[model samples]
Target: MKKVIKIAGILFVLLLCAAYFLPAVQSYSHIPGEIYILKGSSKTIDLGLPVKADVDSSGVVNISGETLEKGALMQSPLVIKPLNYGKATIELSIFGIPVKTVRVNVTESLTVIPGGQSIGVALDTRGALVVGITGVQVSDGKVENPAREAGMLPGDVIIRANGIEIQNAKQLMKIINETQGTLALKLDRNGRTIDIFVNPVHDPSDGKMRLGVWVRDNTAGVGTLTFIIPDTRQYGGLGHAITDLDTGSVLSVREGEIYFSEVIQINKGESGIPGEIKGFFSNSSGHMGNIEKNTEFGIYGKVFDDVDLSAFGEPIQVASRDEIKTGPAQILSTVDNEGVKAFSCQILRLNDQREPEQKGIVLQITDKELLEKTGGIIQGMSGSPIIQNGKLVGAVTHVFVNDPSKGYGLYADFMLGMLD
Candidate 1:
């Protein structure tokens, strides 16, 4: 009878240890390597473990929490309060065994006006983009591909030819058709520059000298504006970079513009299929802003004086990654001619990203009206502003192909960093 009681006690202790360690391991995996905190504010972090936290610099940040007993049923939550504008390190340990160290940065707070105005984007690439390479029928009935033979790929950007800068497809075509000898071309291939020489062939079909390459110089699309910094008159939009549909390469922007646009039609999304919003804009009169930079995070530029800012309301505080929570939120978007409207949504998950990244937050459309109208996040809504606790938190970036009602978002901090 005593042996049986001893065995049962051992089993109970083992079960307790399993309960404590399982959640600890899962929580440790989701902890970010670094986090940003606003000065004079505090951040609460729950790792779901009985762990102790220690800060390297007490002047920069204060860490307060209690480490529970081993195999304890309850876990303690740590509160990290930022005291000044500086950096600190917090080390977490379980029973005196160091597990993870997180770098903390306390910075000044920032504010911006959340934007949901539909805008048309027109981008002109730095150089002509090669879309295709074909054979040219020469006068002797022989076929030759000068572009392919010269080591030029379909995605290569022709920046210069014969020491002259090439701006567009028309300019490059004129130079190739009028050149007498082998032409020296400077190409930008995947961000690297290379020099190549190609001899133009005289095609019998059109009686013109040709390189047998199809190129494109510009692209146009519509997207929602994300935010505007009222102090600097700068704005950001399209929480992601624009890429070529044919080559799948990011277009190198030389100059671009954002114009006022109005949505005219909507193709609702469904399972296994994506949808889009059709909009129209005129470049001659509705010019609202000029694009200065196009990065993976978003596009940033200065808003024009002619733009109307009354509908955007007042500027709101921007939330850091640590401040975002998994709960109910709202998003501003324009699906029809009704202008911008706020819709209810839920933040399903938040990724603990140590560095700037896209798709940091998973969101689902919970608003019945929004779901009924556009069937969740569709095209032309890439930069719809996400609001939580009355603050601008992030922007919508991508929609899940398998589930159209769900989508991913980019943090507003990443977009704000690119404004400079």
Candidate 2:
């Protein structure tokens, strides 16, 4: 009987060891967002927006900002957009593996105002919304016009003409105060370049000149790098469409342009706080690659300069969608000290088609270096190549909002197929 008891004790000890060291109990899941994958395959991804909702019974997963339920799922479709010329994470995912973000360009009409009651639109400083303005500024007052008698300044930029662009100061001042429902002129005075906006302000006496707010022409910051496809000498970036960030509208172009940027600055990030990459947008005409487009996948353009960008010997092959094993990997981006540095990462959680967001691939970081600067993957690193098993799997797409070290990537096959 004592011998039997000893054997039972030994068995218990072995079981304990197995429980302690073996891989985790394939638990609920990884990360913060709700999960929802394509009903069939993980290859099909969704890039749409999500709204708050109560958990439903079938095909539903609930996710919060910090905590997560392992092995559980909640949502569907992934939507991405870029902000500040792509410098900030308007929407990005970078925690573990490759990163991802989408760039949407908005084109707005220019509002010109001469003077008096205004007409036209003005773009919010962020470039998101363009609304009708009623005022603007008066420059180089005409001699015979009431503007001369009204004494409008030369450097004064307009905020609203009672608001819009006009032919000359004559059309202006002559129409002041006559405005009932309309007012114009919003402007700025920068050195010699005087700018005028058409927004309205209230004026009681003879109402000579009035402006509503301040405006600027310069746009700065970083953004994602979509793709660099080649047709002999040229390469294109952004596999999909370019839309306006503020309005969430796509841009139609005669011909798109590419620029070579040197990374002079970086902003390291943390949970709930994302970092950034800074570079100069140049018009120096990079090597002329090619430009092509597809409604489903978006656009494909080429880069000109053949320098180091094209020199990488072997390209990573796109593994079968079924072959993307969730594990170790790395990405090639322009974050290194020398530029376009390669960083380490881990495959934290993956989306199976049966799960929620079947939007290609998602990963988490295990690299300390990348975690130190720019969190995992910040803005301007999108489209960086994800190399695994000596194959080029996809490009970075989004960064996890709450976690800087983790993000998302898209299958290169999907993006490349669109180009062909």
Q: Quick one: best lDDT, which candidate?
A: 1
Candidate 2 residue lDDT tens string, 1-420: 999999999999999965853332212122223221222222223422232222222122122321122222324443221111211111223222222322222111111110000001111121111212223334434222232233334334333354454333344444543665444344333323333323334444444544322222212233334444332432223323444454333332333334455567787767787677766545462323334441334345444455455443333334544446678877767764365556677665556432223146787767787777677877666666666665555666678889877788766556655544
The candidate that wins on TM-score is: 1
lDDT, candidate 2, equals 0.43
Off by over 4 Å in 1: 1-34, 44-59, 62-86, 94-96
Task: Give the clash count for each candidate.
Answer: 0, 124
What is candidate 1's lDDT per residue for 264-367, written digit by digit as tens? 89999998888899999886648989988888888889998877776578899998777789999999999999889999999999987767899999999999
Q: Clashing residue pairs in candidate 1, if any?
A: none
Which segments of candidate 2 are over 4 A away from where they belong? Answer: 1-241, 284-299, 305-313, 352-358
